[model samples]
Target: MNRRERRATAARQSGRTSPAALCQAGFAHLRSGRIAEAELCCQRALTLDEQHSDALHLLGVLCFHAQQPDAAVEWIGRAVQQAPKAEYLLSLATVLERQDRLEDAWQHYSRALSLKPDDAGLWNHIGDLLWQLGRMDEAARHLQQALKLNPHYWEAAHNCGMLLLELGRHAEAVECFDIAERLNRASAALHQMRAVCLSALNRFDEAEADYERSIALDPSLAETHNNLGLLHWRFGRLEQAFACFDRALALRPDFHAVLNNKAVVLLHLQMLDEAFAALHRSLAAAPDDAQTLFYLATLQLLTGDFERGWAAREARWRLPSVGLVDRGFSQPLWRGDRPLEGKTILLHSDEGLGDAIQFARYVPMVAALGARVILEVEPPIQQLLGGIEGVEQYIGRSSTPAFDLHCPLGTLPLAFATRLDTIPLAQGYIPAPPATRVKTWQDRLGPRDRFRVGLVWAGNPDHKNDHNRSMPLRTLAPLLDCDVQFVSLQKGVRDQDRAFLADHHDIVDLTQHLTDFSETAALISCLDLVISVDTSVAHLAGALRAPIWTLVPFNPDWRWLLERDDSPWYRSMRLFRQTTRGDWASVVDEVRVALEGQLSARRSRLVEPSPTPSAAPVPAAATA
Candidate 1:
């Protein structure tokens, strides 16, 4: 017989004449994927009793499954009004939430909770609603309540983990994920989330193993591959990262995040052309993606395409990476849009200390426009920048100085439409430290028979590329073998470098007394030259017009463009680059040779007559 006749026969055989019995049969049919039969049964029940809440609720569920949320809401509302049951309230709340009526949904959920105070599933649903509304802390509390109500609630545990992950409590999130995995080992998504937490905690090996496990569980999931690719990228495993990204793309061709990640890996591999192509595809997929746009700007700037780079780099302010420091200023950003003449402009440094030093050259240019300039920068560099010539006021960052306009220090290049060669004050705009601080450093040195050189072999450990840019004190052994007396310019030394520093008593370790950038600047002025990795001290040295040799990585930051020894930003600075990625040994070897050359040049100058009197030395940031 046909399906309808069979259902009728079954109904007759079961003697299901009452509305409740028919509604029960309707739910059974719905669970079995017999949508038409389910609807028929529910309609028959509704015909028998027009106010049957169960039948109405069943029909609402069917409508919700059919993507008719509006009709589902109508049916469920009637059912809840007639029955006032907890289940009916839950159904109505879920439908209202689907319709984006969050407040109405919340009220209904509260009513359901009031009726059934210990329903773990209902508590989980409430937590989900709060999460959607961006009430993360409340959502976490509700999810925790759900877990407390039922320890075996896998969904609640997973939700709690995800919420904690969003809150950046990776350790707590990992604990929740661990509980969830114990409950549901076959969940690929659970393993992937655990891997993300591990990765955030810098547990690379554990993170990679979990990612592999997740991929093994569900090979079809594109996001797992994408996330695995990011993990590989973090450790400089370029080939593996590229492979994961390729696999993700193969699984889902339009995955924009994977595309951007692939582009990043390509950039690291020095495949600039391919990287650009990937970024363009990503931008096409998500036109206004800030991270993608920022990478594009980075590529342009790295390749000396300043025309587009300066303008595109403006996307940094809108990026999530910059969100914490974005000053949401009341005054409009002055990008040379209006005349600066007679207007008070607040120039703020919202980036690294090196960036503040490098971009401080613009303060004089801005003041020359007849506008009063207020320089707002980090406290360390405030005294060092007292001699920028045109700064009307040097205010602490906490001060809310009244101004007609404001601009990020980094955006000054774009303000003037800076080109390849038009960088102002290439010969150095920042002045030397006061003679008093210089004398303090000189007295600390006692005797000056040996050539004085400042050394900074490491950058900030917390920096994303610190592994690539920084080296241990032991790495500078080749340089220390020279006749010149080396002074430590590093502010914070890693635990691994402490032993080596202690053993090498010949190398000055007066960093304990160097309280701020002003002290560091004064010490740098006493030295003949400053040699550092890509860090703030390198920039400080260059800005002071002191001789500086910066050791650059293979894929250096955008500001240090490719294949050049000299910097346009700082005329007093020279760059020493690694021919291969992470090959610091080669860079050190080059620096050693250059040091020998500089010593020879110094001896030749001493022997030969000089036209000018002998003079001194210099300092690099992120986010430089």
Candidate 2:
């Protein structure tokens, strides 16, 4: 009999066409893209023999092609109930994945992998799904397996390269992108990702070119402009970075990351109000963004808004950028609300030595709260800090101490709810090294009347803001014009600086003999005045209540606050700020003019003159 006659005879004899014939008809209709006919045929077969897997599978796939993933998943799920074939499972997974049921799709994909171990497309699909799930290393490995199965798999290469870029394996990402570029030369995504990797490696010129190329290929690309803005920001091109961020914002107005970046550039340009507005926009979009919170906190602190600033500043402990000083302590943090009465509190140093010195003023206040304070400090300043009134004992980092609660020294102000007006003060808080330690220096010069000034033009080399804050020693030569003896108090001198020191006349090299900060403090004790850039030495001098002039950058640290000639933290400190960033000469001119005035007055004294406030040091802010 002909196939149609046989089907009709079977249908008449058994009350319907056989499931196999119905499935055959369904597939035949499906092959010709007759979706309606295929679906009806599959439904009839399922009604006759509900467990017919192939007919159900065909209908599920047909529904998927017909843009009905919900129906496809339901039909495929029914097919899976009857013994599942590998192909059927894959179709189910695809429909599930389209419905955003990633875990269910992953399980089916895994099952299919077990059935067809050598399928490259299966591996690639699973890899892409894993990438979506953020299993970066696993995704890359599976992608690599797909590429091994088929060497010309450009999609796999690109995917693996993108995961590698996310993982910060820049060189490996570059290698993968090169292979993908050969296969898909016109892809803007490929170029943009390659530029991202290059920028991370600080290959700025090449990265810039690639960013431009990506934008040229796809004018609608958003990330390329954002990344180019970041590259410009890295090299201090503030205006260009701002422009790029503006372009990115035009495309994606609610882009919080771009907004935060634009805020940072605005901050660099000293556009405080604009930066604040940008930060607020970012915070409104992503309130939990730790980096943005900390940035905003710094702005608040800079503007002397301590109440909200300190609360927001606590976000640093949770942020990756700050690395959240994870001491692994079981004790909870003591925010100001807690009563510390009879509690043993471990107050530990967190940041640099200078920070420890600056905030050490709060230690006594903590002790006054009836809390027994155990102070832990950096080794250099351990001895110096031991003299503070509140410490029960000074401990090194290696010591393990049992305490009821603990706080970083930086957190003390926050714990006390300290305001700008309420900052505790104790001049000569840090004592000079013992008389025995300083006797040699005391005996070397028999109290000469020549005006002596201790000088430090540079700070630690590794400080993040050192490039902007520190000046070359040669720039301080203008201070030599005044009739004052310049004494070099700079320790940890670079080899380059040593040559400059040797070339310069009349700078007593005390750095060689200075053993510690105690010795540095003793040397400052002998000087008429101390002049230094923002460094540990400056902090030491300020804490000791020495007549010290702090040479600060235009955008000084938040602790220095904004637009002030005096430090609230140190009563003895007189600030010489750079009106223009990197303009050390103008700062020196003010110092020189002040010194000339002081000496001109000193020379007029009939008898041996004592250094007084008749012609006291001039702050750079005063000069302006």
Candidate 3:
């Protein structure tokens, strides 16, 4: 037992029944975890002297520890009234705060602070309460005061760091974490929190070191493991990421976020069955989790399970990670819930250029339903896509046009109840480029003497999966070696590719003249074929019914289903998929062999001409 317990035992053995002695014995019993004995002692002391403030305070503490907040408040308030002591007031404030009587708690806390003006712990407590109330600025001030009063206050420093981290002030949070670490180097939680700040600042190596240190200090921190897994996931270390997630799940089986994260890595690894199982388990743990549901939708769509995919696709808007704004228009969103005989419906683009291009096919179908369709899409493709058959009006991103109902373009598939077989315009729907624009491209190119191909090797670098979907221009050297005219349809070529492009003069770089999708479309119309990676250009070529061979990654975006050479969404598109992840060489080889075969077939057809008259020579410009 503690020293107080020993003294209390000596007093009891000597038959000392004084009120002060009994109160002391009670506190000793309470400290030693003898709840029944402590309560009996407090009652006996109160019977001897009902106004004994120490006995009353001990009883209040007992009630608090027993989870009787109401009774604890009554006893503590009585003790405060009798003694008017700072410690008694502090106890009363803590109990009142636990009961969520914020005003009462503040009154008691203010009384205690007034009595003990320099109490650093009291300042920290108030700061913590303010943080919970979302009074961030006040919380920071109070926490700073606590630190100023006691520079070595680890708790206050840690609290300040957490607040800064919540505010997305990673650099400031790291400074606070540094202060905390100096005071307590053995704290695993401190290391973990600091690692999160480092990760946010993109100091990956430092973050990894801190994560390792935290795990070494305490292996049971499931949150630390989950965070480390996310870092690994960002770097594409799939196996390591899965291991960390598995460890986190083992520590906390009901960790729904970890389960969801694990499923995402599984999806990237093409372990569809495993990802499906993990997502279901996460839903079982937390059924209404939007992120998990969105991932499940993505997995389903990737595997061509369109029925369930479209059903859950609406969850994307609810996810902060997707960053899709709800637009919150006054008009209700139409999801085929009501007939639209004469109503005007706004169909706006919700995602990237390729997605807008792919889903714009739904405009005609919506118009056929007797609704006036006003299409709002990104400005870059607005001119080209404005000509979609059913679009009565085409506007740029910021328009607030009059419409009876609205829907994001991504949600159109669900509104149409689209399935694998029900995807609209598989034979292509986008109208041909305007004649004048096509003529502009024709004038730019004099003649086509060889097979003409447009090449797009990369897409937007900021895309999340750009590393997987896009390749260096050098990777296409084999394909470019073919005896054919090549024109770069790629915009925004990276600095790494600029030197190669300068050396390879055979490959025409005409992108400087192509300002928007309209210009690109007109140029695409003149080319015999388009060879592109998964990008907006590929989608454009497909929608225009132009011949397109799209190179796909091993684990492609949801649109390109597994192991298929053809796309259900685009009939004119042919897929060339990588057999392994990051193996662009193999894909390039396959495309090169296909190109050579097509050339050989053309030569044979030309020599075997018999009944049909030889056609007029195809202009060499056609090759571009």
Candidate 4:
């Protein structure tokens, strides 16, 4: 009885301990990352007790890590249904996420979080899901809770920063990134994100340094390279920008923003073909990208491909800058499809002042088609444009009169299908007679014998190409010292030019007295000639049919065309182009030579005796 009883008791005790012991050993192996050993132990435990929840959960996790999510879900679902626990539910949710069943995964996550509300890991997962769903505020709240639960949770901190970055909270994102660094996470992603925030805040030097650090850590991050390219591009460092963009493109060929960015750099470099090619690739990648479509239209216009450009450029209203303007129109746009024979067309002022002056030439042509035209123009240019032939009424910005149809001033060229040859300029359309302000200007000038030439060294500083189109006042100092009464025609002066003008008292700074463009036009009418950089004043001179010479940049605006001595847009305008980028020296020299020749001609005319009255009235005298 003793031997039999002893043997039976030992057997029963061994059976009871087998499943629990196996389950414990399986978890220990899993923690040690010995997958095969963990699997063996888990299987043995399940074999001993087929319904063991710990063994089932461990097996499900193994299947998930082994890339068998379907099996993992099947096993974890059974474990969860048998005994409801937060750990089992969490594992099931993760497996579902890997399977791309986000909705189901979300439900499970919510359930798990309800059971374990204070778990930092659970909160992190919830935050991740909310972020992906675009619930940024909620995602941020959840992520913050995760960090509050566990201050050392680097993943949660990093994700919160990423969410903030997307929300355009750059300063906050940078701070969050700083908090994340305390966890000793030194990945490329952290540095890259910090760089993006810094760049947005215009911290260029810090952003560039961070970019370098990120690229050094992980050379394969195409986005990091592309961002660095943008940094370089903003500073006009096209060469460096191109190199970084090319690297990003090679790393990720379908990166649409990168392709678009590369095209911008190419455009600045004046490589039109390469620029368009990059643009095409970007459009192909994201066909509905409104910004890219609008950019393409701008490029087409630059290349003088107006027909296609206009068609694509209709997207201009979608651009942020353009969208900000008051473009509201209850009436339909007249794209020349409809006859304007008897219609009242409201031709509104659009774009810059120069464009308004240059395009006013078309109002007469539009009216010649038997349509009554109303012009809505900027208040400053209203009086100047009032004389335009065919404009039935001149309206200011505050006035919106009744009209049968409406069109932007820019759209007229497209509506008219204007090519280079179709450009029409009614010389002296904006006429300002010499006698109109003769006394006013003469009194101010105090009887100048030298040639009276008006000067404008700069255009609007807000213009994107002002750096190239406008020259320094010092650059024009040589021309000002000549035997001519140099009168400044610039109404808005640069801060840097005040000192230069003060040093040279000969230059008559009449801008202070010039109230509006109309006053400027009257003053200009009393001048012998006008010398100006590419500005609205140049267009005004051209419109008045005054003798004018314009300084053109190397990559001049499309209106000036590529290599032309004269502009079809304005008949009285002569173009003096830069042979090199940002070079105004050559342009100044050319203007000086032409001015000297004019002075010589005037001197000769003054010295020469008037031709004896051609044998006139002699017959009557002889008869007497």
TM match of model 1 to true structure: 0.82
Better of 1 and 3 by lDDT: 3
Compare the candidates by TM-score and give the number of the best one: 1
Please report, in order, the local distance difference test score of every candidate based on alpha carbons.
Answer: 0.89, 0.84, 0.90, 0.84
Give lDDT for model 4.
0.84
Candidate 4 lDDT by residue in tens digits, 91-192: 999999887787788889989999999899889888889888778898888988998898888888898899989888899888888889667556888989
Q: In model 3, which residue pairs have backbone atoms overlapping below 3 Å? A: 447-620, 447-621, 448-619, 448-620, 448-621, 448-622, 449-620, 452-623
Off by over 4 Å in 3: 1-156, 167-169, 232-239, 606-624
Q: Rank the candidates by TM-score, best first.
A: 1, 3, 2, 4
What TM-scores do the predictions have?
A: 0.82, 0.73, 0.77, 0.70
- State, as a TM-score between 0 and 1, how close model 4 is to the true structure: 0.70
Q: 1-624, model 1: which lDDT tens digit per residue?
A: 447446655775787677877887788788888899789889999999988999989989999999999999989889988989988988888888878999799889989999998989888989999898888998988898999999899999999999999999999899889889999999999899999999999898999999999999999999999999898878778788889999999998978889988888888778999999999999999898888889999999999999899888888878766553777887898998889889999999878888899899899999998899999888988887866989989988889888999988999999998988898898888777889989989999879988999999999887877888999889889998898999999888889999999999989989988998889988998899999999999998988899999999998998899999999999999999989988999899999999999999988888996679666542113331
Q: Model 3, range 330-442, lDDT digits (tens) per residue?
A: 99999988998999999999989999999999999899999999999988899888998989999986777889999888888998899998888989988888899898887
* Candidate 2 positional error at 483, Å: 3.6
- Candidate 2 residues lying further than 4 Å off, grouped into runs, are 1-175, 233-238, 426-428, 440-449, 494-498, 510-515, 601-624
RMSD, model 2, all Cα superposed?
9.6
Q: What does candidate 2's lDDT look like per residue over 121-238, in tens digits?
A: 8898899999898887888888888888987889888888988888889998998898898998899989999998988787889989989989899967777889999998878787
Best by the lDDT measure: 3
